[model samples]
Target: MPIVDLGSIRGPEGPQGARGLPGLTAVPTDQGLADYIRAGKDSKTGQALDLAPLLDKPTILSNSRRVYTINNGPWGAALGAVRDGIRDARILVVSDSTGQGVGGSSMDSFPQRTSWPSFLAQLMDDLVVPTAHGLGIPKSNSSAQPYDTRWTLGAGWAAGATYVGFGGKQTNYVAAPGSGALVYNDPRVYANTYDIYYAVSNNATYGQLTAVATGGGTNTVQTGSQSVREIRKMTVVAGSASGNNVVQITNSGSAGNVTIVGIEPRLSSQKKVIVGNASVSGSTTSDWVAYHDNTVTNGWNAFSYMSAYQPDLVIIDLGINDAIPSAQASVETYTANIRQLITAAESAGASVVLKSMIPSVAARAAREAQYVAALDSLRYPFVDLFNRYGSYEKTSAEGWMADDVHGNDRIYQDEGRYMLQALIMSPMSLAAKSVTIPALPALPVEGWSERWRADQIPLTVGSDVRAFMSVARTALKPESTWTPPTLAIGDGGRKVVRFNGTTDGLSLAATRTQPHTVVVLGRLRAISTAANNGIVGAGQSAGSRSSLFVSTDGKLVINAGVSLTNPAAVPTTTQVFIGVFNGNNSVAGLTGADTAGAAGSEGATAMYVGRLGNTGMAQLDVEEIIIYPRGLSSAERTSLTAALAALAK
Candidate 1:
């Protein structure tokens, strides 16, 4: 049988090779397999093997499930690497002088730059706190109140005429000759000795004044004669054992209406703020910027010292001082400044954490609430210190503040603990959550292969011509003078290329005579105010070819066979998107203008950017440019316009 069978006697394909290993229910392609592996574990079994035991610490899953191996080293080496990373962690503390002991003394244990950095250093290593002292920003000493006292009634009340409360009308407190005149009893005053501010309205009576507080004899904090409407601040005594201090104001010479507008304990000089040094606190430095009457002025971004420090997290504890009546900063202005700060900070590669302004004194309670409300609406990592200790009423009752503007040690400690948690813990990864990417409009299943990104192109510093990607691969050839890629401006730290109008331009190799779409993200230079500033063009001259330019009226114009108008103006400072689609029948353009066009023919030879051949030289800055072989659909055009608009912002 063996001799007879041989190679000539083969069976009929052996039942199709036994069905080829069950036909793989799902195909594992590059994308498919990656997604599957990311899902982890066998779906049917619903179980996962502990690969760490077989491999090592920080194990990574291989491409194939069947392949598994141990790491090159032991777990100790991996842990050492992690420790090094932890040691190199950079932490930045941005706060008022409270973090640097401006008005108050620093805590002895952590007496240095900022107490937060020192405390965090004690817990972990590699913490870097930047020195904010040299930022050249102003500082304030007088505490910032959260409310605007200007909203209260009797704003111009006489100096001697008393007001019942912050919202009260004019009232008179006339004292009998030689009899002590009693003012309102305030619980916030210090039991030992504290400062009291009285807003007197037109005090014309000249008299010998004697001030008294609970559980203390009369002490003359100030002497007033022939007083006008003025704010008189004096140190007075208080009642013993947390009792309300009955403040008495007596004028021996004559009886007159004396008014006490507001009274609260002033921020003490001994109040401890920041505490740490650069050496023991892991290169952290706290600058004392908290001064009297410091508003949210400019120069916040320009940190003089430690300019090289990149903050991992930026804490902004401002606006309380800015909300004061004297500061005169509106909530809108303060919020705008804060937004700018956040953008700048985030742009500098740091996460921002906005701290809510704490409760202010009773006089500015309403204003503080508005400021806090503004902060609450902003989109960022936020810490509600105002709510943490207790809200305005509770804070006032619990005595969590050294003064109306700054918090005591208890508040600072609690805040530091929360901050430490945010720093140490992993912020929930965006990857862990399901991502929903809006699907792009599918290309017409036809020709549209030409693609070019200006940012991706290669160019030399002094080269006359640079090559770019396109259906007709064009190169930028500057004729005489050109500004190279230096000016950069964009959100998210994206940079764009700039070109001078007179001489800077791109030269194309061959004529592109097919129906094509051109997309550009660009902005006009400040100096270029000409009516016909070319953005992207493809032809020997401006009028004879396909091109998009800013017309004399500042609106975008497309000259592709026929001229089409884009309703939006080209912004000089901000970037804009200009798209031109020369279709089979008609040529059109868009600037997020979404304009329609009538049917027309098209003619274009060589391509040019920043200038229309040699005539319409343009001083323009371009961020990105794309040229497709075929015209784009309405959906694709709209989507691209919107996407580019977001980038411009």
Candidate 2:
């Protein structure tokens, strides 16, 4: 039987023989052989097949990523870099420039050449709201009024009088009540054409009212209805004035009533002082744009020139020039300019820092001394470089200056160090180490007094908002406790709590029943896009639960499960996350318009802030929370949206 089929003698397989124990099997597919060849491993040792140590690696790196087994470790030692895993290569250039120039030139030179900026650019890890100064200072023509004051005559402005004409141009007033003396408070008022005078309070300078005169021969200068002094002969050139001649009423010689009227302000070029910057044009360099207001040839308008850097912190060193004219100058004016700059900086979302003028030698010190004193009295973050360099000495050996005005090289270096130190020592900078939350945009409390405000809890304890949630560190589930997220400084420079989405959350008492609206503002992280991920939830049962959640697809679902995925998906990069529910409709984040239809209704029992109960743990960062008894109208919603957007930005 074994020798049978030779050539054409193949016999029909006699009853297919039983398959015997599938002997050493031939690979059924080509993959069998390919797999063995592709198994990159040492055949005998079973260890990963090692490639000959890489002889060379890329010396340059860029935005495109590349992997390499580095030799000569971090410090460039072959032995040090001998590691197992490959490193994602990147190029980082460090500079050690000490900066240039000295004295007055140093201010401009130091920023241009200093390498610290590069370092700072690298260390700016987390996204934080740049510290800003208060609201911007109003300019002569700004739409916004930094300061406003109105005094109507006992009767009113010439019946239907609206504005006053100076040099054929109408000078308008900001606002006027029904009846009172029309007094002006425009800061841009100038005496170049006509002498200008105003009343001062406690020598503080700001909030002064311009004077009015009536009698022809020797008119009495009066602010509002009160007489202050007398103007000898009303004189005018009938042309445009260069700068305002601000006169202090207490020291003036006017007590007559002149037809004085408040001048309305002109609008700012674009409502900001710094012209070009990252926010305006997209350049990232210096933190601030240095400027001097109304200098020779450098008009007030010229002060608007901006650099590429959008400053989060601005340090202004002024007063030296102003004090030089001490005989004709006042400390009040110096401080007024300082405040204006501060307000402008704050308006731009930059923290304000002021530096006193460097000390001067010889007779100039007498005038600068008073300026220094006044500068120190200001209630702001101040750095006194004057006193630090000693009072005043004529010789370069005794002072930090070669001349009476400019500082020497060492002086400049010291100033730069002090500036850095001042920033490092600031409370804002200190808090910046962890997280910096900006202030929340304030809601219009105008009609809030009438509406029944049940509860407006901030959920923050002092500066630490870790207790923002109802449940502190307790676990949502029975066995697993959650690690409460830490507090972070949020947009608008305010305290906020971070929710791990797993166990971090807050529960509030039910203050509103039906026809109520709840608003939650925070940053969300979409980790596990499981269904029913709670952002804000409260209800009797799952079906009727009023909750805002991230759907399984990472889209924002709000108001009883009504999903609004217009934004496509919330970015993982923590951004402004807003959720709103108005009993009937709901909106999530900055998505499509409100979704019509009833969201699941919840009983007026309790409200969950971040996570609802245990199952719907929301990975979030809560910046603010609000619950209104009544549903908000479309207009109100729009307003709220605008306000919240401003804060988040």
TM-score of each: 0.32, 0.29
Sliding window of 10 residues with minimal summed lDDT for model 2: 275-284
How far out, in Å, is residue 376 in model 1?
A: 2.2
State the lDDT of candidate 2 residue by residue for 163-192, as single tens digits.
Answer: 121100112222232234443222322222
For candidate 1, write residues 348-437 as lDDT tens digits.
333455666556666655666776677767745455555544455665565545666555544443344344434332121212111121
Clashes (backbone N, CA, C under 3 Å), per candidate, total 26, 55
Give the Cα-based TM-score of candidate 2 against the true structure.
Answer: 0.29
Model 2: how far residue 480 lies from native, Å: 55
Judged by TM-score, which candidate is best? 1
lDDT of each: 0.42, 0.35
